[model samples]
Target: MTSIEIRHNLFDNPEVSGTEYKTVELIIKKLQIYHPDILTSDIKDGHGVIAIFKGKKQGKNIAFRTDIDALPSGHRCGHDGHTAILLQFAEYIVSGNRPETGSIILIFQPEEETGNGAKKILQSKVLQNLHVDYIFGLHNLPGYHLGNILFKYGTFAAASTGFIAKLEGKQAHAAYPENGINPAKAVADFILALDSFKNDDISNFKQITVIHVNIGEIAFGTAAGDANVMLTLRSFTNKGMSELINNVTSELQQLANKYSLKVSYDFQDKFNALENDDVCVDIVKAAAKELNMTTESLPEPMRWSEDFADYCLKWHGGFFGIGSGENCKPLHNPEYNFPDELIDIGAKMFLKIAEQAMVD
Candidate 1:
């Protein structure tokens, strides 16, 4: 199958985060052609695929992972780019030319963009049974030159937690403000409250805090029976993240009560910060250098969250960002395409990483 066509098939489907059946099914089918050993299994109602390749000499079990899910708007955030690179790499590995040593586990996880797939996979017995010693993954970075790898020694990406706050109030004529509990004011107050709590300085702590509260749809003619605000909170450290989330929640409650509006909040922990192990970094860097690919350390923690953090928690693993070049549009942009040249390098990097980890 043409890689472009595969990209289209995956890109066209807006698998979203929690609901990623279409894309996962397609990836499973594609992998089956090369590796009949591939298995399509479900994790807590959602699907996650796994395939294993044993080496000539048994040393340790190593896993290379890739996410097989897209965003809500579909093609945004370069999911298609990631799929293309991963598929290319999968093809390369299935060609049966790997070095002799530890076994390889190829994990095509779902809902990565949602930050749930890694956690779901971790909960499963498959990963635990494999006893994977090292985990390696990569993502496409939009702001840099494509095909370049940015690796960090410590935490590379921030922890992202998002949720929606639903504010319920009495709806009445706009003419009488006191007669009706207008939620519009509550929404405004919530926005102000979140903005006031924004912390942009990284030097104060391990990483900066990012808080975004955007007002969703609101009916103006009506007094506003319902109003909602989508909140995105991010920070480098788990403790900082906890504190930030608590502050936002508490402030929201106060604002809602002040306006006499009944409020209920549901917080979904989307993703945790991606912290890299130094040992994994050294191995991957050496692999990149040997392949003649330039590598650099990340300057600051990526404010965005990645589901890969879930994998890093249990396994000695790391995830790096591959530059998509300055000319390339930013991630989640409608006009985004994965650079084809980077596919080979990514494959080579993982292969080397697996080899190095499994060596006796």
Candidate 2:
């Protein structure tokens, strides 16, 4: 198969936010071409696509996943590279393969950019009905070099939540300050209050905690009727995150009330921390070792969050990120791309990991 062409196709698809259903559908069609028996279906209005490949021997059921969704920025986070690896691997596995141990389920999920797809899938009965023994997932990382695997035994990623705070103020004319309440000043005060809460008093708080608040918009020359603050709260543990969120919310509410402004708060997308089981990590590391690839041991935890955490909540599983290239590019960057060489290595590693874990 032409790996370059597959990569190009995946990258060029442009499966941006909230509309990844079409991309998943296309991948399903491509996989169906290789394995006629590969059953494919859409779950929750194309939010997720499920495909199953049955093995000859009767073993436990297992699953390997890759998210198919792209960010609104489109191709900025190297999501195209992820989809290509998954499609290529699915084709390699289901084409009358000789592995005689267990079945493989390939899931291409949507809405990952918003961190809601996995949670929605968990709520449904589909994954519960499959009785899957284990699950595996991976993401691309620049600067790590291509064709390299990074594995962690536990708590690989942090917990995160996106928040929106609405404030009400009486709008006043730009020239006439006394005519009505000026929300612009209140909004500025609220932002300052939120930033003040970013205290470095607690040890490790600087390393693990992050609080970002930005004023969304403001209007003048009218009664300051509405204002909003968009904030993101994150931490490595549930306790830290809960504490931080509560602290900031209380502070912001108090400041809004002091300014005689009405306040409302809501959370948009939430991603739980990723905790990898020891057995699953061992399985992945052993498979990488067999492939003669140097597996870098990740001893430190990452503060980024992923929806894959939802899958781990149900079944004992693990997730990691591969070094796609050297001089690692941060995610959500337009210049990033998933290295083509890792397609073969990633697929082979996945196949080995599956056989090792499920094929008795």
Candidate 3:
């Protein structure tokens, strides 16, 4: 099947993180046709697929990966296209321009949106048995010239985690509100205190975005005894993110104590900052140059999070971006659709990177 066909198939039947069964099944079916030397769909949770092609002569082993799960809703994020690109590159390896030395591993990784897939893959028996020398991956970036290559030497993305604070107190009739402790004031104070943690310094960037807040029910006769505040915290480096978490948690406990409210904290979807290997990054730039592709260097790391950070931390690799278009819709927008033209550019880019890595 063609790459565009594979992309459309994934788009028509999208799956979210932690529930990528159909996506895995379809990828396995297409990859079987390419006849990789070794193919696996049963590693760990069996929600992702791995295909391996070996060269006749022994050399370095390189791997390329793509996030396969779509967002929880709206079918945004361009993951379907990412999967198609890797699948197309796999097909090319079998049909033409086979690597003269070393091996190629195409990893269709699931649960990237939930920040669990890469860790799971790292622990999988399949990956543990194979030693990979160099690795690479990419994301589609909107608001740039279509097919342009965008990269950064150090970090490509930021570290981020979700925060949930639940407050509990005594409830009472609204008329006699003094009869019980109310948490409304505490919740308000907590949110305002969170603002003190926000900063945009390029050297030490940090951010706290409130995603949700809840304060009891709408019944006017009753005083709210419980409330919740949900936020996403980000930083340019892993150490900075840890500091942000520590400071916020300490202040949050103080607020709970001051208001005599029982508070609990829950953190979710933690992603480390993606720090690119300098050598791997240079290989990507060289590959793009070899292909005569337009390239742009990012002035700073992106404020977004990526689980691919997990792989880069475990091994040497770099993550780059493929421009979708200046007018393309922003990711996570309900109207967003991955530009189909990116399939060829991204797949060919991976091919060139594989060629460059075999000799590096």
Candidate 4:
């Protein structure tokens, strides 16, 4: 099948994070037809597919990963395009355009939107047994010029975690408010304290945003006895994030004690900051130069978080961005869609990188 057709097929049938059974099935079917050499759809616990293409002479085992899961809002993140790029690249490898030496592994990872897919894949014996020497991945950037490649040397993205704080107190009758405890004041104070955790330092890149707040419901006759706050915390470094989390926890505990309320908190959607290896980044630049494609070096790391950081941490690799178009809608926006033109561009880039890795 053509790359465009495959991309549309994956985009039309969207699956939310953690449930990509049909997506995996379709990917496996295509890989079997195109590559057929090494394909594994072995479902143990996590959802993912691995395809290996061995070359004439073995040198280094290089892997390229692409996320296969879509957001609850649908394929607004362009994972469909990413997956199609890898699939087409696989087709290129198997159609006698194999690397001169070494092998290539294509990974279709699941649940990336939930921030646990890469971790689960790494833990699974499937990837651990491959012993990949180098890994690479890419995401499409909507605001850049079409076909332009963007690279960063270190800290490509931020470390982030979803913070949730809950408080409980005794409800009080409206007529006699002092008879029981009310948590409204505690919630208000906690919000203020949480905001205080945001460091204004430009280098640290720390931020705290309150996403949700809830107090006891609408029956106006009773004072609110319980409250909760949901926040997203981010930093450029893990140390900075740890410090912010510790400070927030300490302040929240103090506020709970002062207000005489029971308190509990938990974190979700945790992501480590992405640090790109300098050597791997040079390979991307060289590949772009070889293709005569435009390239840009970002001045600062993106505030968004990506699970690809997990793979880069384990292997000496780099993750870069491909431009969708200058006027295209941003990722996760309802109007956003992956452009069909990027399929060939991304696939060629990955193929070039694989060739370079084989020779280097």
Q: Residues 27-65, candidate 2: write the lDDT tens digits.
A: 766776766345545465546667777767767777888
In model 3, the clashing pairs are none
lDDT of predicted model 1? 0.73
lDDT of 1 by residue, 248-283 (tens): 789878987788878887767667778898998888
Select the stronger candidate by TM-score from 1 and 2.
Answer: 2
In model 2, what lDDT does residue 32 have?
Answer: 64
Which structure among the candidates has the greatest TM-score?
4
CA lDDT, every model vs. true structure: 0.73, 0.72, 0.90, 0.87
TM-score of 1: 0.81
User: Cα RMSD (Å) per model?
Assistant: 4.0, 3.7, 1.9, 1.8
Give one digit per residue, the lDDT tens place, for model 3 in 1-360. 688988999998998887889888889899888888889986687498888888898888899999999886736999999999998888778878777787898888988888999988778777887889988999999988999999899889999999998999998999999998899998888889887887889889999999999998899999998998999999999989999998888888898899999989999999999999999999999999999999999889989999999988878988999998999998888888999999999989999999988878
Top-lDDT candidate index: 3
Q: In model 4, how many backbone clashes occur?
A: 0
* Candidate 2 deviant stretches above 4 angstroms: 1-3, 36-38, 56-58, 95-102, 123-125, 171-190, 193-226, 256-260, 327-329
Off by over 4 Å in 1: 2-5, 8-22, 36-38, 56-58, 72-74, 94-101, 166-191, 203-227, 253-262
Candidates, ranked, TM-score: 4, 3, 2, 1
lDDT tens string, model 4, 235-345? 987788899899988888998899899999999999988888898899999999999999999888889999998998899888999999999999999989999999999
lDDT of 3: 0.90
The number of clashing residue pairs in model 2 is: 11
